[model samples]
Target chain A: MQILDRFRDPETGRALLARVSALAEQAQEKLGRRVVFMEVCGTHTVAISKAGLRSLLDGKLELRSGPGCPVCVTDYGDIDAMVAFGRLPGVTVGTFGDMVRVPGSQTSLEQEKARGADIRVFYSPADAVKWAEANPDREMVFLGVGFETTAPAIALSVAQARALGLKNYSVFLANKVVPPALHALLVDPELRLDGFILPGHVSAIIGRRAYDFIAEEYGLPSVISGFETLDILDALYNLLRQVLAGEARVENGYTRVVKEAGNLRAQALLDQFFEITDVSWRGFGVIPGSGLQWKPEYRDFDARVRFAPEVAEPRIPKGCRCGDLLKGKLTPRECKLFATACTPTHPVGPCMVSTEGACAAFYQYERRSS
Target chain B: MPTGNKSEDVILLAHGDGGRLTHELVTGLFLRHFENRLLRELTDAAAFPVGEGRMAVTTDSFVIDPPFFPGGDIGKLAVCGTVNDLAVSGAEPRYLTVAFLIEEGFPLADLDRVVASMAQACQEAGVQVVAGDTKVVGRGHLDKIFINTTGVGLIRPDVDLGYHRLAPGDLILVNGNMGDHGMAVLAAREGFGFADQVVSDCVALHRITGRLLDELGRGVRLMRDLTRGGLATSAKEIAVSAGMDIWLSESEIPIGLAVQGAAEMLGVDPLYLANEGKFLAVVAPTEVEKALTLLRADELGREARIIGEVKAGGGNVFLKTALGGTKYLDLLAGAPLPRIC
Candidate 1:
């Protein structure tokens, strides 16, 4: 906690911003335009907005929020399936609280729960497994949705259920990996990017070395950053410094928590019961090898197979530009539905529904910037 | 409504049927703890004397899960919530009317504990229960219990507080820490393992409000209890009401370390979390020091600080970020749900 206090100290934050401002000047002068950077994690999007960094930097640097929010990027078809599972009899839908109010084609878990469906919010997948164990007569389906940071724990739950031979416990897999989505974002010619402020937690699991391709192949400056005001400023400074020095490399700014190789044990756990597969993101349709699926031997623990919910046709709300916003092609305010039709209460898109979503962070913290 | 338990320890539907059991439960239990002249008359309405002054009446309901929490229970919250509402409006809290909705199978001992907590809080706040009602539904019809409290307070002729009295350059002062009650309740309800560390700051705020209004008078422009939507939301409402901007310093806002840590882990901002005992007092800039001194004298306001100031602008609330940036704080858009990733 003492260490965290330093990260939030106003004096330290001011010093870091001063250095970042000077480097940003040099980078912008050399580039003959704004020094654009994308923070490629939902948490970074929220942290940057909450700290009001975008308004502080203003014209010096353009920080675009990328496709990082797992909940926002979840395909509508998957949400519909989860909602369908909630309506199924003798089945209890267990999920993180974030997924409850997210709208599907017909309804949400919240509405289903209100209408006599058994939908429960659990803090962890292990708790859902425990609930399933206690109620053997009821089938429990845990919604497994997150990035690599949460995948290991969900994998552990699967491993635990398998070890215990719990017949009623299953997981609805909507887990995603980060790298392939980044690859998809980089290939878009319309979306311009010079540097990347990478997600800290995801990098802690996949390691800084995993992003070598961004520097080696794409020749873009990137820094893994923690979710703090000072940490974000330091990352922006380092990325600007790299641009000024004519270097395109991935730097580890969150070295205290992240390492070059990342957590190998967590990676092994993910590999044990899951395999990479193609997944559909809300904005980026289908990104190959970006999602996780149960291994063939662990297929029995998969909710999609156990219940076979009849998913409805995915319906996209009109005027919701979450796809464009997630791809960094448009800002939240750029969308016509942003403050008018799309809000946190009556969200038209997943971006406005999730807390880590770029649209929500902008609406909640920085919309009235001078 | 009978479950065939026939146990004395648990409540049954007959307790609310207004017959023999209902009579015993009220006369034996409620009358003993709430021994006031108005209530002892047993009339349908407990009429009380009032001075020649405007009255402030407010109603609030408490349906908190785990009716018992770290610092207080639903019963205590029921009293404090209504009392603070009237007190912040520059009124002297006097009488309260309580209504309880209990599930049939709720334990009698837990109900007694809750009632005892309410009685103690009422004594501390110097309020009496003038009228009351109790009802019990089927086991599944309601949660364990819910309490609604209505408070009536008298405002002295000289006391007038409202957003209309606010102006530019006014200072914003909070009594103490923000987000304690909301975070504590969340931790307790979810069994988040931090319940022991983050205790709720639930108590009556009438003492602090009464002192400020008495000593400072018009120097205190407005006072609002930070209940739902926490400090940020209340500040935003004040800005909108006053048609002026409010600029808050992020560094000056008081948030306890444990609540801050819990908020970070849950991915919810403490700014939008709820508070029970804390409130925002918009005061004239000249009286800011005196107000702080008075607040600090009380144990509840010991951590009080000048968090922000009113500015000349259109209706909006902004926070000067700790890192030297400006961010807008809108009314909390939705429930502050924990983040998934």
Candidate 2:
């Protein structure tokens, strides 16, 4: 098996960085200002954090983390439901690794499994189908997690499961959209972000049109970036240049996969199994139409009907400023438990549990970069 | 459905309902696979000798999808995961307690390998399999394989390092690059489907730690492996516990090229991804030169360097970029690489 789907062509990497560095120089010289860009995807958060792109920029340019993590934004209600689903009889709850340790209102999925619930983690919804086929007589419920990029896959899985007539399979849909989140961030009074680095995966699904609001309404210049080190640099360069040039437009630098209209077949498949709903976020609270729900027609595969999770008022641990950190108001180092009481060995929040969190990213790479 | 003597095919609900049938299934099938002391005892809790010294204990759950991943299986991950925990605590990993929940009909051979991997990883970490328990669930009850392992190790009297002991003028050092393990698993899973091969760097770090202990002789004030949350997390943890601030440099951090590539493909950063055989050491600034020199002398620590310093500020971790700017590094506010460690 070939281990590489892609490699860093030094030439391409250098060119991209040079282009970005050039733009940074142009923005710094032209605007006489520090250009700030917000990347709205959790994956982008990892890309930006690891590549040290933020540090490589022209001194005048700054990039900040945004409300990009789907698990970070998933509400306590949804998490509690998933956890409860973990304990259900004859119900094996399949999910992504990101959702396992999230502190639900009652118990986390990890904890529920401790009590012997059937909570399984899957890389994609397709794997869940594999599980269902392997256990024809047993019920397998896969947790539909992630943003637009992941939602389409979940939709496809639900459709496939139905097509295969797997009566024992169900879906716990927690899929969310990127545009609604961008919408909420724009109107958010607490933020003063200058521009947006739109998530490449989400952009690939909803396309650049989804972020039109950021440019048209909020006057924030947005650029779509790939996950590569140079890709982010280019996004930074593009975003900074636009701010300097006094323009707000959506630009897609990841042309390989993302399209203006995105995958229509994927859109049709998504509408087939799930519908949008006003949902809650982990740190930022609720945003209207930001979440996906299994349609009533597919209630046979809906775990919520067969199972309802018990929940409580989700409270951030005392002195744990994760909520604020999610808004990019505080960095991971600012947390009282960053390296001490809260660590990979003993984490208190989802940010620590998932390696892609901003705090973890900074610690491993940037903590010593300077 | 066939009527006469239906053999085991799919899973049964009885396997997971915590009933008598579930117990029988586990005892009848799984208990015979490994006859270790832990398996023989078969209790909810595992108790073992605790030397007359401070102990480091860690608990982690395995919830990775595919239930199994490439490079290493869940069992190997389970043992290494906890051994690394105790190892980074500066404790010679001593023992492990394992618990398993098998979905009905998981192949007996796969279970054997999972168990064997756990044993092999433990032997490499110089840890004993003290005790374990198992449960089985009926059809659709649980993932194919989920293993939770808890570890305990005794810290040597000569060594002293804890988060609370962090000082204002300590240097932060990283053993290697971050995010290889997490990205490896993610890319290996169904999502990315990249033709590129990314395997989990899931290995025990105790041997590497032993090497560092021999070389640096007590200069180590704090040791934490960059695992679930990556390096920034441990630094922030130190700052918060010691009621001090952290000052780090980004250019000094070490990262793998493949990991870098994987993160780019996934739109994720290698920093926040998880690492298995890596650690972040905080030592006295006076010893920074000695530590860096000594660390570079070793193969494991060759990629090692002094990345940052502990500061007097209260509870804020600041990063001064190579380009001369400062940004606050904070805790994971959300999921970065979930279930990675």
Query: Which one wins on DockQ?
Result: 1
CAPRI-wise, candidate 1 is: medium
- Please give the TM-score that candidate 1 achieves against the real structure: 0.98
Misplaced by over 4 Å in model 1 are: B1-6
Model 2, range A1-370, lDDT digits (tens) per residue?
0322232344565566767777767776775665566777767776566445666563756667777777766667777777766666777888887778777655688788878887777766788898998988778878876777787777778778889988878777777777877787677788777788778777777776767777888888888887766566677777777877889898988888788888787788778767889887777677888888888887877877766666555655666556666676667878888767776546676666555666656654465322
The candidate that wins on lDDT is 1
Global lDDT scores for all candidate models: 0.90, 0.72
| Model 2: lDDT of residue A116 | 81
What lDDT is reached at residue A119 by model 2? 78
Q: What is the interface RMSD of each candidate, in Å?
A: 2.1, 7.7
The DockQ of predicted model 1 stands at 0.67
lDDT of 2 at B269: 47
Q: Given candidate 1, what's the lDDT at residue B47?
A: 88
